[model samples]
Target: MRRVLSGLVLLLAVLAGTTAAAAEPATETVHYTFDGPSPLTDVSGHGHDLTPVSRFGGAFTTVAHNGGQALVFPSPCHAEPCPRIALRAATTTGLNPGRRPLRYGASVRLAADQTTKGENVLQKGFSAQGSQYKLQIDGLAGRPSCVLVDDRRPQIHAAISNVGVADDRWHTLECRRAGSRLSILVDGVTRGRATVPADLSVSNRRPFSLGGKGSYPDNDQFQGILDEVWVRIG
Candidate 1:
């Protein structure tokens, strides 16, 4: 009888351990889906007087031929490849920047034939003049696949890379920042790890984009589909 009781207790302990592991905090999702003739209308505090660019400009829009709206840059700051998807820290109306201990994740469909040049699909510290940090995705340019840089030391800090992520297909990439340690995920698998400065914050007041720019390929135009961009805070 005592042996039977002992076995039952052990089973109960194992079940409890499994439950605890399942309850661990997981990455959450924040999506800004887009679709329409006026695709930028989904964002708040936007006005009608702003100049329009192509079919996918303003705040958000669906302007690509891939049956989904994209963040389009018809006429970029410089001038084919200039199309891009950008994110800015807009606080006029004051929306809470989600939770703390933030992690960023995204599922993107990139242009199959051509991809971002000079580095990886992920680039940081992107200012028209210059930036403090940069994460370059170099596989798009026929280079070895890896996260190019972690440029967030001074003002810009903590850059990550999902090394095996490729364009022309849907991929899920994630970056987790816990204290000073950083972990990157590509296709739902952890690919790289790094230590970041405590003072590092990659958030810039300027807007950041995907697909198009002025630095490479005449204009940095992103030719693809992107969806399910999620920023999680632990």
Candidate 2:
């Protein structure tokens, strides 16, 4: 009878430990549909909303797309202090999943004529400052790419897709970082993949940004339309 009681106690302890571990805050999601009347509202329940920054009064607007409204970026500028426009989180808190798995992406539409050397879709932290995780369209090809910088060491890993998304059509682009791999997916299809440190972590004070980094020059401003944007970390 004593042995049976001890065994039962051990089983309950094990079950309780497992349940507690599962209840830990290991997963978080923030989503911006951009379909609502106010683009700052976060529909993902995590309440990671955004604040807008623009150089011009009406540089950024919204248009109907996918049966709902979508955010539109400003046109390309070749001069200094151009019409800067972007959306940024009020704070960086809980947005960086550190070394844990992370996925971020957006539904984008851009014309070939609007393509630039680089168009930042979203980013947190700067590569030169500690660590960062970013998604962007690169070069005149308007190729989608994902970049991850490790805070444990000086490392910048990127997976750039060959598929050009700039053709005046809407496309879903996803950037995923898991374990030792960084991948970019277009329309739920894998387009590129690369390797990185498995235990890397990215933590920085920079605010999470969309469309561009701010009004600063060479901000990698995005020029196009963005529908649903989301981030998931675990």
Candidate 3:
């Protein structure tokens, strides 16, 4: 009987050890909390520290929720050049996971502050002519539109015309990448879809950012709330 009991104890101990070893540690999540009726100061988890891109008085701010954060950028950059709030990745370590055929995701609510510029919106990824991919949302005249640039050539093969989420409410946005096909969904609906040949070489090396490009000094910038930006690999 003693031998039998000893054997059972050994088996249990081995099982426990195996369970502990197989468990995966939780990934760290960073949050930049905010409250309504207030201005922004700092944004976190961008992998890099942030600096105000415009001379505006406030920084990007957020509100805390469910261990996550809400982000907001105010607009009306009326100067000769539209004002912009930019977020640069801290370091490649945790920011760029190097997952090719990368799966980019986020939830955002945006408006184009194009009082002067022709268009207003938010843009992400690199915009170089022939190397990188760009994902953009153009919210102009209180209308929401999405565009996908598969190659740096500024060749836009797919676009969603009337996204229409101009209200001040929060909207969910998601993008999926597999091989040469890039699919996009807004507010949980399929808005725009495109397939790019692998030869184009759209990749996951360049860092992620918010705010419009500065190609033209008078381009538009985004205004409103941006929340729950994340990336997932499946």
C-alpha lDDT score of every prediction, in listed order: 0.43, 0.87, 0.49
Tens digits of lDDT, candidate 3, 2-21: 99999999999999998987
Error of 3 at 67 (Å): 8.1
Tell me the number of clashing residue pairs for each predicted model: 24, 0, 7
- Candidate 3 global lDDT: 0.49
Give the poorly placed runs of model 2, Cα more than 4 Å off. 1-17, 23-25, 56-58
Clashing pairs in 2: none
Ranking by TM-score: 2, 3, 1
Pull out the clashing pairs in model 3: 33-62, 34-62, 34-63, 47-90, 48-90, 129-152, 129-153
Better of 1 and 2 by lDDT: 2
> Candidate 1: worst 10 consecutive residues by lDDT?
90-99
Whole-model lDDT, model 2:
0.87
Q: In model 2, how large is the Cα lDDT of residue 158?
A: 92
Per residue, candidate 1 scores C-alpha lDDT tens digits across 17-107 of 9999897655433344344554434242232112222222323345554476655333323343333343432222111122235565545
* lDDT-based ranking: 2, 3, 1
Shift in Å, residue 164, candidate 2: 0.8
TM per model?
Answer: 0.51, 0.90, 0.60
Error of 2 at 214 (Å): 1.0
Estimate candidate 2's RMSD in Å. 2.6
